[model samples]
Target: MWWDIVKVLYIATRWPWPVEMGRQRMIVQTLEFAATLGEVHLLSFGDPPTKPAPDFISSSGMLEMSGLMGIAGSMLRRPLLPLQSHLFLNGPATAAVMEAAERIRPDVIVFDMARLSHLALAIHRHYPGIRLVLDMDDRLSKRYQRMLTNETAGDLGGTFEARLPGAIRFLVPRLKKLLLRVEKSLMDRSERRAADVFDAILMVSALEADEMRTDCPGRADVVAFPPLINELPVPQQDFSRSVRFVFIGNAGYAPNAEALELLDRAAVQVSKNTGSSDTDYCFQAAGKPLAHAVYKKVEVAGFVPDLSAFLAGNAVLVAPILQGTGIKTKIIDALEHSVPVITTPVGAEGLGLTEGEHFICVLGEDDLAQACLHIIRSPEARGGLARMAAAARNKGLTSQNRTILRDRLTFAFGL
Candidate 1:
């Protein structure tokens, strides 16, 4: 039988069974789909207490031991922990994976991220017959480099060249830039190696797929398989409350922190400008605390596990994100729950959503306030946006889309 012939192994950097963040959500969704094709085995780092999955063997103890080694390795290498993690945990993880492969004699192995591609390469090196699939969730190297640069730039207060007036400033900015470049180069090499060794590379978006093709050329087959959202029943809610805008995301992230800060200032100004003295007109912020000051006006609902129920009570979901890459899973989650979204251009990427029809897109503080005001005062407008969001969910999670993902997985693994 096809299932008998194809025993697939999935290797991930983090535990996937318990979907928490966007990456985990993608991992879980992919695993769910992959399970339907054949017998799926998962190997990941130690499971979090809050998040756990039912399938596969977990060898996370190795990762913990690797972390201890990473601290010792840091003395030799500047960023020793991260490097050691890549080397130690990945090496042992790969070894254990190979042993499993030898026992199970699986036809193929699916690596969930570029970080775990080390395992895929190891499998290819030992068992040359086994096909390997690389799941490129994001351009990790580029994303990290971008984050470092943005942080450095923010600290420098201006461009590197422009800020080099003081005696120490010249060397400081140059050193930071050089370090970032080196990090990017090293990660780029790892990514390239992973791409070259893998039989196929799967990405979450067309933009990301194009990037991988440009980087690795003909060495790997790159395809974009978007994350799927399971259709959940949304309870009817009263949209008659005073303008209460909701923003959902892990607030610990820098981009989200900045978005919440922007929303806080904008919301305060909007409330005052509109002459609305009602406290009911407020901003409800969900997720962990990023910045202390930003939590002042914003009502913090820390990490609501039951997101659908949380959305059921909220009026409109706001994603005022200014930066980040890939699709916003929060936006999709909100749309799936029939909650109207008002987001920035960056927040609404890759969803193929029409601005007004699907949700509102506001660029500036005033525009965001105005949009909130419109939605709050007009119940009909809010209802229309909610209906459009429900429609988007229907189109995104159709059976045809699931088949596309299944076919891609089958072909990639030669099942």
Candidate 2:
């Protein structure tokens, strides 16, 4: 008889398969890493009814105690659940994950985000010996607090719909601020308690790990584990195209939506300044919709089937994000495709890209327009930037990086 492989269960608050956004990228990467070790079991909630299945044997929250609990939790949590889902908690999702964990009795349990730490709490209560890992995607409580503070400080600007004058505009921000404060307090306590219970608290960036260390002090072990992107299956090259610029991301996101608006404005100014009426230069955007004026020069591709092909066809990728947290995976995907990039300083954060070397980094609107014009006008400069991006891609997302992550996981779990 064949001996059964040691089982590892991954609990996600959102659908992990059919990778859509940056968080999905993390889930897919984690699944790939876990597959290399043992039989990996997946349990998820909060996806649409018809979301595609994962490669592994999986269970959905369509008809089960966990599923019902998830639905109820979503209803009760209301607006909070959507934001909470990002951290992997949301009430119903966690309940389903807990039920799955108890049934599976896996040797190790990994919670993809802090919101899902509740499952770790539940697991420790029943199966104390099982290794527990909390993958802190970011310092979430701090981020929420930052948002609250920004809103209160009037630094959020009028662009945010939440700042508009209405019942929702007035009530929602106040409610969100109150809820975020309460959630932050509860989550901070939960993190400390879970840190004592779990084997490792894995953070996405060293800066995040440092913040956690400050919070817990000498109580728990924390490790920085940045996200990993799979190596490109194709060769890198600067695709020869007529200066087409691309920006790929979920346009529904406020930062990305704002960036697109800003880019459109900058593009118009650049066109007027250069006295070019012809649509020789195009700005192609991919992903979900946003509230912005569309122009003949702008093409909204809306969620391309193949991102690599889209990037390869464009001359440069532009990211003019003014706000947000976490590493920008769009930048990584662009670099992976060896596409030259023009971005704001905020867009290039955590990637360790050198200014004017790996990509062009600009600060103001005028600078941004000028940078775009310069890149579009100079083929030699674009080529050089593309070469640098390709090199950065290899250094950032190689087989070696994956191996290092595998080893780190092994050590963290004592596998």
Candidate 3:
């Protein structure tokens, strides 16, 4: 059969709208791209707008399950499932998925995240020979595992100790450890099941894909495709006064939250070392509210509608991501926007971005501060970094790279 004749159905746990997060944007981009190749249908749990698109099917809002009832049902039916899975694998969501699959009769079913991978078995049973593809973009299990390891190692920098009151800090670590342990156990089982069920498991990072493959020895082949950017912005030309650093992400997210804490610490040290007042340095945060503790130094620009425009206006994109799994999409976004970046080596993982060439890599708060100051002081350095980053983005991640990713997706499912 020709690839164009393949019917693809995408099932998502949440609505892929507004394109705020990396995973969400990936889902949206895939759907849009896939529609061009074949007949595509989207079924998701998030509430749809009043006038939803023809191709988009949303779960009926008929019965809003009571919180207690939902919890009780989850606990009874799926004792070992993670809380997220329990919330998603409900009656309404299942019904919606089945209805869409039946109506579409898709040859290929794409689960946007591991959360929806449980549906693969049921869909395959009903459809007999459907190709199941699991796009594990977020890598929830690996992210949580890293967090667990960090917590266990007593490296809880941006955890309960910082968030909660000192009075309860003693108990917070123990409670957190218990919760993470249980969640990790459940996720391990769930991820393994996902690997066993899906024909192809798509990951954003090669390291994560390898880890998944190791966990489920002879299951599906895990494929790694770095974060895809459909378009690239023209490189920023002007590098002017006032050293400005911008960080973009949902600040509520654990990894981003921790990274923000690091940024805050770095900002303080930078200011103190340079004898620069708050006015001399600007830490603009986009996508979510800045932390209250760093409110004085950081300016909160909640959810900028135009991310590219935001990056264009800023001097450098600072990504001090301490811990997370999978590729950092914001870093790619910055490079694509032609804005030089300052990120920890952890942030640059899996992107094939060189430290000195593409962006400056700094380790501790002190190093990060010095890096920022150096970039601010040196126009030649700033220009060179931006040029290198822009060139890399153009060569590595734009529409040209989409062909490679699209080919991989198609080949994986025998489209």
Question: Per-residue CA lDDT of candidate 1, range 94-189, in tens?
Answer: 567767788777777777677555566567778998888888776766665655756523222121222122443445445666655655566677
Question: Model 2: runs farther than 4 Å from truth?
Answer: 1-4, 47-49, 58-99, 145-194, 218-220, 233-241, 276-279, 291-297, 398-400
For model 2, the local distance difference test gives 0.65
In terms of lDDT, model 1 sits at 0.66
Work out the TM-score per prediction: 0.80, 0.79, 0.85
Candidate 1: misplaced stretches above 4 Å?
Answer: 1-5, 47-52, 55-65, 68-91, 145-179, 277-280, 290-294, 364-366, 377-380, 398-401
lDDT of 2 by residue, 349-379 (tens): 6666677667788775688789777666666
Candidate number with greatest TM-score: 3
Tens-digit lDDT track for model 3 on 189-271? 78888877888888877777777788776568788766675566474555655557998998766778777777887777766
Error of 1 at 348 (Å): 1.6
- Backbone clashes in candidate 2 total 3
**lDDT winner, 2 or 3:** 3
- State the TM-score for model 3: 0.85
> Clashing pairs in model 3?
none
